[model samples]
Target: MKTTGNTILVTGGGSGIGLALAQRWHDAGNKVIVTGRNAEKLQAAIAGRPNMSAVSLDVTDADAIAAFAKDIVARFPNLNVLVNNAGIMNAEDVSAKRDLTQAEATVVTNILGPVRLIDALVDHLAVQADSAIVNVTSGLAFVPFPKAPTYSATKAAMHSYSVALRIQLEGKVEVIELAPPAVRTDLTPGQSTREGYMPLDDFADEVMTLFAVEPTPEEILVQNVMPLRTAEANGTVPQVLERLKAL
Candidate 1:
């Protein structure tokens, strides 16, 4: 994707990595529109950024996404980039009594949400000369985090889906999968900040820099995520499991 001059729509752009990326693009003179579940947060995100706009959207709602796609095409005809960044992470105990309903909610938001959004916008994206779709996955996709099994599985599914989407849209649009390591975001509440995940601004900077140079669709893994990728590629799942246990 081109580094600048594109109208981009980012899901879950109210806070964390999504807002950070939106801010960077807006500062670079691009038109940026952000969508999230909370109207208040979305409004706050674009308050001081003249080039940035916000829309309230819940990715988990299929009908809502269908309507959103139409609204986007009608309202933001110049939009060429779509960022699938909304996701949820939750810790669940498999052995203990658990509510399957809660796990399903995570699956819907993390996996089905992107799938539905892309399906709704694929045609619109194809019509653009320089279009891109960015899917924010996670390092846990390669190696599952025991505490957040459902969340990991959803990200793994997203990673797989992104690969397929890229192939399907080969010449139509650029598909980039950004698999971030633990970032200092609200996704983990207080834990992420305390656990030394990459700072939000630092990760966003690296991602934008990578986009400026790379033309082809590829996975952008930040510093801490490299080990997980390597271990998975080398068939060292057991060793990685041991390391996770130690953590």
Candidate 2:
């Protein structure tokens, strides 16, 4: 949207992509509130920040989401932007006799959490002018990463959901999907310092530019994420799959 003067809530905003977005928006004069399960982490993220705050929220907990939504709505009555940025990624070997514990958890945090939060806030948003909902999916949503199968699947689900949500909320709220590539974030252990990942600041810089677009685009796709985002349409799925296999 306009990128400024809106009250925004971002889940999993303690670090990584969420942190970057929260800070950038806050800098642009928006009152930004970030949430995380870890209270300490949330505090640390906004330690020296003005116009930015944090709240403890375990997105996987339906009850917690409900309470947090009520509290947040009362606290920030002008809230108009909800960024569904909280997500988890883990490597799962489908070939093995797996318990699927992590996979189930991934579904809860990555998919259910955002859906629940949206359900809680949709009514509030519909009444606000120029409201927006930003769902953070991934480049992997377009091409599955063999190792993180469930994570990719969850993101794909969000991608599909965002499309429908946009049409359904056509006049009431703006629906946007931000499909991030392999950014330098610790979405998985060691991913922060890993090779072949985009630098966090660099990615954030590019993303902020996209967010400033007038008549905001439905999908914010950065340059690095374009290949996979367009892979299916260009008939490069096989080639992309092979490349992913190597990674």
Best by lDDT: 2
Model 2 lDDT tens row, 28-61: 8999999998888889888888899999999999
TM-score for candidate 2: 0.98
1-247, model 1: which lDDT tens digit per residue? 8878899999999989998999899999899999999999999999888989988899999999999999989999989999999998888889988788879999999989999999999999999979999999998899999888999999999999989988999999989999988788888769556666788888999888877775643898777788787886798988887877665
RMSD of 2: 0.8
TM-scores of the candidates are 0.96, 0.98
Model 2: residue 161 alpha-carbon error in angstroms: 0.3
- List the candidate 1 regions with Cα displacement exceeding 4 Å: none
lDDT accuracy of residue 50 in candidate 2: 85
Alpha carbon deviation, residue 131, candidate 2 (Å): 0.5
Write down the worst ten-residue block by lDDT for model 1.
Answer: 188-197
Query: lDDT per model, in order?
Result: 0.89, 0.94
